[model samples]
Target: MTEPVKLYVYDLSNGMARQMSRQLTGRQIDGIWHTSVVVFGRETFYGQGISTTLPGRSHHGAPLQVIDLGETAIDEETFNEYVMEMKDHYTADKYHLLEFNCNSFTNDVIGFLTGGSIPDYIKDLPTDFLSTPFGAALRPTIDAMYRRPSPSEPTPPIPSPIPAANATPDSQLAASILQAVAAHTQASNSTPNAATQTLYAPIHAITNPPSFHSFLKSHRAAVAFFTAANCGPCRMIEPVFERLSEEKGVKADGTGAGFAKIDIGVGLGNSLASEWGIRATPTFIFFLDGKKLDEMKGADANELRSQVDLLLFQAYPPHPHTSLSLPAVQALSLNPILFTQVPAIDTVLTRLSSFIDSNPWLSTTQSPGQAKQTLTGTVAPYLKARFSAAPSSKLPSATPTLLTSWSQATSAIASALPVASLFPLVDLWRLALLDPSVGTWVSSFPTSSPILLFIDKATAALKIPDPTSNPRNYLLTVLRLLSNTFATPALARSLFLTTRAALAEVVIPSLLHTDGAVRTAAASLAFNVAAFLQKGRVDKVKGGGGHAARDNTLEDEDWEVEMVSAVVEALGRETTSEEVVHRLAASLAFLLRLSPAYDTQLSPLLDVLQTRAVLKRKLTKGGCGEDGVVKKDVRKLVEEVANKLCP
Candidate 1:
């Protein structure tokens, strides 16, 4: 009744169709079939029929047709035309047929059918071959072929989609995705692996009225956080996060796993948050590219630090390029003290005793016990050697007491242990310097040690009375060190004015320093110098007695004049902050009062003040009120200087 379908079968040599015939028997498989020509050397054969074996059918069941177009030398175009002829002849039956061993034929049949190759494979054929008439018919069947359960394999159950009602929040979703990605990246060992593949996909939001996807494309490594404006935890940890980013050498622009903040409370932000399923506030999402790597919640600084470090190590191991070492303090050379014979114990003791006599804080007396025993046992031998030699012969009874105290103190110091020994040495030095009786002992100490140099200079600059002798030489030595030491300009400026010669050497150098702190300090020291010169002059006019007073009253005033001019020049040349300018202006005013004879030089100072006023005006226009105070101060100083000079 269905116009009994005519069966036309084609097969090549080696029985490819014959084999397929055995595979497709008994399943109502009524059709015309064509099979590929298998090529060996140069032989050729036409089609032939073979028996079919279909599912749930026996060997005696009705057999379907199979054809084998055996070994041929036909060109690709000829083979394609032959297949077409078969398709045209059997079009009416709407054939259900299986093609086998078609591997030798070029996919040109599809090209002829569609005038071009198809873009995708409908069945096992390459995409370019899928557009042929035969290919179109086979499309649905081929799709089913892939999904068909194999005789030897069990089928897996399909998963259902997530329900809308139980859908995750956008924030939570984003966090989850990030966490999953991070875990995958950390665990992945292959190049085109799961993590890299995932990174290639576009990230989607999980919320209603879905937001546009926001892709992360950083040139350097980075971790991005999508957050709300009012997130308290985010705010609290911002500084720490920034510091950690810097420590890891990550750029602010997301290089090397840097940090970037996104406010997700706005239009696009809300959409993205919804899409990412961010359920909680202050959730942090880590990403390597478009793919999320990890996520974190809550605001624990320590936990965040640990997580960041872990992730960084995973992404970039601590290889040669990423390794870091702590900076070391530079070393300095020290002078070697000369020792006389293999210095005997008594001689060393005597020298140490003399040192102690000059500096009394290092006492020999101690209570006996484990503590004292430990202390003496550790320090006694060294002390004995250090003070082993006597000063050939002693001078007077008074000298002996001083020498004895020095020796005992030195012995106590050299023999003492740890902080115990060091503390007493420092205490003794401080006491000796502060005391009028034995202050001369300080002169015997070397200024090579930075700590000792600082003390010596500070004492000299503070001008503690003269039983200590003039600290001029100590100050000079300290100045040399300041100029040469790698100490910061701030430290150098602190000790700039220990003496007249020290001031002369340090003031100019500090003023020219590139650092702002050094420049400001230099300016302050200049003011101090001006004050000192003025004070000396005033004292001289009032008949204070001293060779320094009698010899250079005018010279002191000239120095003040010159120093004030230098301050003015510096103000104009240096790029100082507003606060620094104000301070310098105030100092200039003080100098003006101190040296009124140099009234003409007040003009340049006034000009500097005016420049400061202009800067203040600009700042005010920009709504910076704090800087206004500095401007006002400078202006007042200017007015005062002008008034004093004119009056």
Candidate 2:
């Protein structure tokens, strides 16, 4: 059932702003607007973080206006999931008086629920306030007021030690890869594909003809299980039918087959059963596109299963790739390589400041006051104060001021400093991308934004004629930033779906970089891209592929060939770092795994590149340098690809 969604608009000034606005700011601002969403018996708002309570129960006593936003078809469970995700983006420290504040949260929620926004006056108040001369004069003072630590705020505890740069993040990466491999293996070994499909809809009970027909009309295929209470065969096969419903029934995306049950005596008082001409107690009638296809009058479980498979086959023809016997590729993990390690925020900021202060051009580009306000005052304070919470508190989202400050800083750095001096700023940007909120904001832009522009500039720097002029720190930091883009899957998908060619330019060359760290980071980025393609292929093979999902897939056929060639070449050259070899091997595995053109493209490409010989040399030469445990792990991963994939 749909729930009524309402907007609760409160005047934060309580009539004072309208009375004194002309005297204070020389602008007649009628109200200081704050808004919250009221839905499902709760009033939700964001301030010192997001809070929800009974309607009309928040600290803001009464709303100045209650706007009916119509009904929301969004269910409670899905809505709650959305709120949890929003928390990561709308943390308390992220609140900005003139930017991201109470009304911003309400606007987001209202959009999620009803696809509508609050009144212009409420949303535009911040922009209006900041535009005035008097308001602009007070902006810094206002920012300082909120940036001040609250007296009641608890002292922050010392953060746990971060892992050394040389240490591999084997625990997190290994666990994820092993888990994916285990699931894929189990699914492949399952008897029927239905056993592995996600369970979404349950076995619906037949009611009146209208409801019954509605169910049939909605699903691609459906089955009506007719039974009587006392029939022995019906009782025996009931559980089997239910199990089938959950596995092969309508999926969450509203596709796939459906299941319904009917009893002659109980359901619709034999109305549906009589209309369908069901005389037998244990009858099964199959449907496709709201019309009866076939029927069977028995409780034979095997026959029922066969009929369900037939229904699905008629609905969605199997992909040709599914017929291949590629056990090695099938068992490969699909988890993308991610760089989630965070450096100390204070240390990062310190290095950034030193870089800025040392350069005369950079130091004087902005006035001392502007420099302090944007960098020292706003940027530094925001990063440090974000972590000044109790140990158990969640990390804060990047504030609107921080985003604005960082963007301005990037623009300033581009003009005042050369490409080589960008390592400090690039390092900070790399760490910032780990924050999912930052990733979300970055992806929301439909065209080239700050982050993308930064990447393009960095990539251009890599292509300069003088190799010695390229700073290794800049290259490694940029590669790491590219890897962290996959930390948020949506951002990763968008990047690949929109800018695969540009990404290929960056990743392909860095794979062959002289520095092992740069090569390792580049391999991780390549692994993420390959993993994304593998996921799309797996989804298509699983029969859940929709037109929209397919649209997000990489359509350029040349990309697969380019990526495969690069990985093969890099793996052959990477003789020292076991980490680089491991990532490159995994990248190759994902690229070749369940590929639609395995016969025509990837298989022939691997053969021509002599990938088997290259991997075999790594195993025989001990090129990863006899680093015992790591060497063994890398060997095992390489062997999985060499023996199973290449052989």
Whole-model lDDT per candidate? 0.37, 0.69
Query: What lDDT score is found at residue 308 in candidate 1?
Result: 65
Tens digit of per-residue lDDT, candidate 1, span 1-647: 11111212232112332333223321221112232222222111111111122321321122234223222334555534444443422221111112211221112222222222211221222222233443333334322322324457543222112234654453233233323322222221222111110111111211112111211432123454555658888788766665664454332122245454445653234555676687776777766545677788877788677666655654553322123221110010111111112323344334434544454343346322332333245434433333335522432221334434444434445444322123233332322222222223222322322234343343444354542443333333232333332122222323332334445445654455555655655555555444444444444433321111243323444445555555555655554455555545455544554243444554455465454443334234232234333455454544444344323
Q: Model 2, 1-647: lDDT tens per residue?
A: 89999988776665666766676567898877778899888998877667888887776777888999899998988788777766754665555455446776676677667766677777667557756665655454334323424458542321112224533443233223323322321232232111111134455544335446655755678998888778999999989997777567654334557777766665242778879998887999999888999999988998898788778766754444454455555565777666656567677657766666676664444553464457666666555555444423667788655776667667676566566667767766676777777788778753424567667876897898788887788778888888888888788888887788889888898999888888988998888888888787766645432212354355565888898899999998887887788788889888776565666787888899899988877776465566422555566778778876773
Q: Which portions of model 1 show Cα errors greater than 4 Å?
A: 1-502, 537-551, 573-579, 594-628, 631-635, 642-647
Summed backbone clashes in each candidate are 62, 0
Ten contiguous residues minimizing lDDT sum, candidate 2: 189-198
Point to the candidate with the largest TM-score: 2
Error of 1 at 91 (Å): 99
For each of the candidates, the C-alpha root-mean-square deviation to the true structure, in angstroms, is 29.4, 27.0
